[model samples]
Target: EADIYQTPRYLVIGTGKKITLECSQTMGHDKMYWYQQDPGMELHLIHYSYGVNSTEKGDLSSESTVSRIRTEHFPLTLESARPSHTSQYLCASTKATQETQYFGPGTRLLVL
Candidate 1:
């Protein structure tokens, strides 16, 4: 298995509904990140945390939000999901600086 996991590989929701994309890592990495990406584009850092209680918004980390409560868990929640929120959400974590990041399969969301 990879270092991370994301549930509900695909989701189709209504115009307004509460949803959360699950992400977890077992590598005990202190650095965790959430990225929004399309099929054929570079990954965009939406949120990142250096360590516990150290969540910082990334440069391109907007239009979405994330939380870092547990060291091994970092989940993204949408209060009201909209059609404009439809995209692939990827979860990644790094063990240390200058290290490769491991990405989850991602959750493909489609809002209607």
Candidate 2:
């Protein structure tokens, strides 16, 4: 299954509601990331983790969120949904020695 899973492949919600997108991997990589993008959106790092209990924000990505208590999962939650929150969320990971990342198909979010 490409080692990753994203639920609600597509979502449409009323504005101002809390939302959480799920991401899980089975490869057991130490690095994980979350990104936001538009239809043809460029990847913007929203969140990431280096290892178990080691999470850090990325420069290219926005100020989203991520956690790594379990190496195979990384989920992002928005406190309040907004029209601006409407974008694509993509999850990715790379090996400790390799910088090449693997990406999920993505979750399409629309806040109305």
Candidate 3:
């Protein structure tokens, strides 16, 4: 299993609040992905990276931004949270040569 973790497992915040969802992995995987999903909905890829300092937007258009400063960490930040942003954010990582992605438990955010 991939040693990945997401902090603040559950969060409730007011609208317009800025929040950062933290994700970290100890497996040293070079590639990582971020996905957003609503309850019982499909997962949409919002961001991904091949390695440190290399980030790319995914198929889904998202207001959130991600940074990859170190191989083990990839945090997503929403400058202004809205009700529409209320969803589950998942983090996953995989080795460059591997197709299997190990995912974290995910952070569930609710904007009030």
TM-score of each prediction: 0.92, 0.89, 0.96
Question: Stretches of candidate 2 above 4 Å error?
Answer: 60-63
Q: Write one digit per residue (lDDT tens) for candidate 1, span 1-112.
A: 5679998899999987989999999999999988888877887888898988778777674656678888999988888999988889898999999898898999999999
Show pairs that collide, candidate 2: 44-61, 45-61
Q: Mind giving the per-residue lDDT tens digits that candidate 2 earns over 1-112?
A: 4677888799999988888888888887888888888888577887788888988887664535666778888888887888988889998887876667888879999999
**lDDT, candidate 3, 1-112, per-residue tens:** 5699999899999999999999999998999999999977999999999999999999999999999999999999999999999999999999876679999999999999
What is candidate 1's local distance difference test score? 0.87
Candidate 2 local lDDT, residue 46:
72
Model 1 residue 93 lDDT score: 91
Model 2: lDDT of residue 95 = 80
- Sort by lDDT, best first: what order? 3, 1, 2
At residue 6, candidate 3 shows an lDDT of 98
- Which has the greatest lDDT? 3
Report how far residue 37 has shifted in candidate 3, in Å: 0.7
Please report how far candidate 2 places residue 19 from its true position, in Å: 0.8
Q: Name the runs in model 3 displaced over 4 angstroms.
A: none
